[model samples]
Target: MPVLLYVLAVAVFAQGTSEFVLAGLVPGISADLGVSLAEAGYLTSGFAVGMVVGAPLTAAVGRRLAPRWTLSACLAVFVLAHVSGALTDSFGVLLGTRFVAALANAGFLAVALSTATRVVPAGRRARALSVLLGGTTLALIAGVPAGALLGELWGWRSALWAIAGLSAAALVAVGRLTPPRTSTDHPGSARPRLDLRAELRTLRSPDLLRHLGLGALVNGATFCAFTYLAVTVTDGAGLVPSLVPLVLALFGLGAFAGVSVAGRLADTRGRLLLDVAGPALLAGWIAWAALADSPAAVWVLAPVQGALSFAVGSTLIARSMAAAQGAPTMGGAFSTVALNLGALLGPVLGGASLGTAGTAGPLIVSTALVAVAVGLRLVTARRRSGAPAR
Candidate 1:
């Protein structure tokens, strides 16, 4: 409900754009740097690798600092990295800047996510967190496309400048708006801090690990379809190439809708949302395979599957943070790590099986992954129920 949360979302939008805008710039980068397209593609992978390593590392390193300062510092690093990236002609320098920017992004997101929950009441945590994630969705819809367009028109360096400007603005906003360290968790009580050992124990928790695993599997399934969706739309579904943008936009809109609805329900009705979503997601993928060749089906199903994927994915993130109550920042970091891990692996797995059956292979592979996750959830629940409590 606070404006501060929205400010955090703005910063997220800037970083999220940086995270995705590389896909559009790969060609320009390859030509300008005299590198292969394959090498240019590694810039994106470098960012992902940085996110995975930086999230937990930064969270641990900044644990003693106030959330506001930690966030501001991260944003400063991000802005500087983008600026440096724009100025660099050397491909290696640009790649290093992306990695540095990703590190800052990982740290900011972890702290911001943790900060979002603490600034709100218990019952509103899910909704609050959703607002933060909404920025990422917006990036998918507006920021990435806009950046890509800028690259297309003005060269890729112009897009990097835009990101730097956006990040600089967000950095100023974060510094001005985020709550100071002295704010109390309750009336007449000092703000609570984590015990280092207890935080480590919570990080190692079985419950938290399961939540992370579920998130990773579900995200993997969702992304496997997403990575191949454009080709599927044009080559498999017989749609024209131009319509690919529309289909992708529709998916982004559906994703925003899913996050909005799930945020409202996930706090109290988490189980209900997941219960309904799991089967629907499984069915959604199966049905997509059955109808993947139809143009009409592609138009309708892109958004539907997008909604299902994000609804479950966002809910898992919220629940995972809940499971790590004693260490919110680290939990947030782990959530980032989990989702990125899936984003990385799912495409690899899907690509490996791509030639077997056209678009349907990805659909089938994604379906199998989700099926494994749903079955694992059921099994985990069964074991927990059977176990005798102390």
Candidate 2:
């Protein structure tokens, strides 16, 4: 584990917190901005959209720049977006800030992942990637909870202010830690030309595309349950509102544990994980839906579900990067887009089930989504082995 990976994780912590903490501040924002809660919720959706758009665009524009500089620029922009968001009086301006901040977040993550793998030994690439992703799971456990508390105590703007300050500190750390130049940045000294045409061609691989789609499905299923987890915890389990954070904490802890364990195995046992995780998740989600009425079961299963979700999610991403090894940086963008696309869709499908299905709706949806992923994986595997597709 390189020290630089931790530094990047810290930066990711600051940015990732921004992605989730908005839910806690929705009430404050809606009241302050004179908008409906539905409207304020769009802030999160806007951020997701921005991330999907920004990853590839930012990667292409910064392809020539050293990653140290790219990461720094991203954190700087992230800081600026938060500062702007904190000071804004208009809801429209705030929405725009969310979009801008997500762009920064997307670019930072894509570059940070690529850089982490490059700096580490090849054998540890998966572990290195997980360490970077740990920051995200950590954000869920500690950072978002803290930010929501800040919003509760001081107001929504205060949460943004805290995020901005935290992000600024991370910016300084990134600037200090990452290498200022790679060989690619060197002028006229055996700089391998990365032909855009060649890279684009690599994206067309069926295997790579399958990995991307599978990654999306895994993420979609995770988000399907996760987005509405609070509802399930509160309304279904009959837990007090205050306990929601504790449940979320359990989920995050499980996610962190999952990522750590999966990271270590992703390089060596990735195939095994891929083969096993889907069925595990399918069972987990089905059990979750069946047991939604049991408070004890819900409590016990939160961590289990979290662990399964991140393990499978991380494995799929590792596989995607492995497949996209031809253009590793662009691979980062593709992975980000796939994962965020899932993030965006998961909530929509889950939300749809809420009206008629109640608390179990999202869980059932989650089960179905992962089932599709499992089927796809099996089909793709058979095809690769020269078996006819079912």
Clashing pairs in 2: none
Of the candidates shown, which would achieve the greatest TM-score relative to the real structure?
Answer: 2
Kindly list the per-residue Cα lDDT of model 2 for residues 1-390, writing each as its tens digit: 878899899888888899999988999999998999999999999999999998888877887788888889989999999999999899999999999999989988888877877777777888989999999999999999999989989999998998899888888888888887664322335546476566667789887888889889889988888889989988988888889899999999999999998999989988887777778988999898998877897788999989989998987888777777677567788888899999998999999999989989999899999999989878776777775321
How do the residues 1-390 of candidate 1 rate in per-residue lDDT, one tens digit apiece? 999999999999999889977888999999998999999998988998888888888888887887889999999999999999999899999999999999999999988888888888889989998999999888878888899899999999999999999888888888888877733242254646765676768867887888789899998988788878877898889899888768877888888888899999999998889888988989988898898898888988889988888888999999888888877557788888898888887877888877887777788888988998888887887788775210
Q: Model 2 Cα displacement at 275 (Å)?
A: 1.5
Name the lDDT of candidate 2: 0.86
Misplaced by over 4 Å in model 1 are 182-192, 386-390
lDDT of model number 1: 0.86
Query: TM-score for model 2?
Result: 0.96
What is the lDDT of every predicted structure here? 0.86, 0.86
Residue pairs with colliding backbones in model 1 are none
Candidate 2 C-alpha error for residue 240, in Å: 1.8
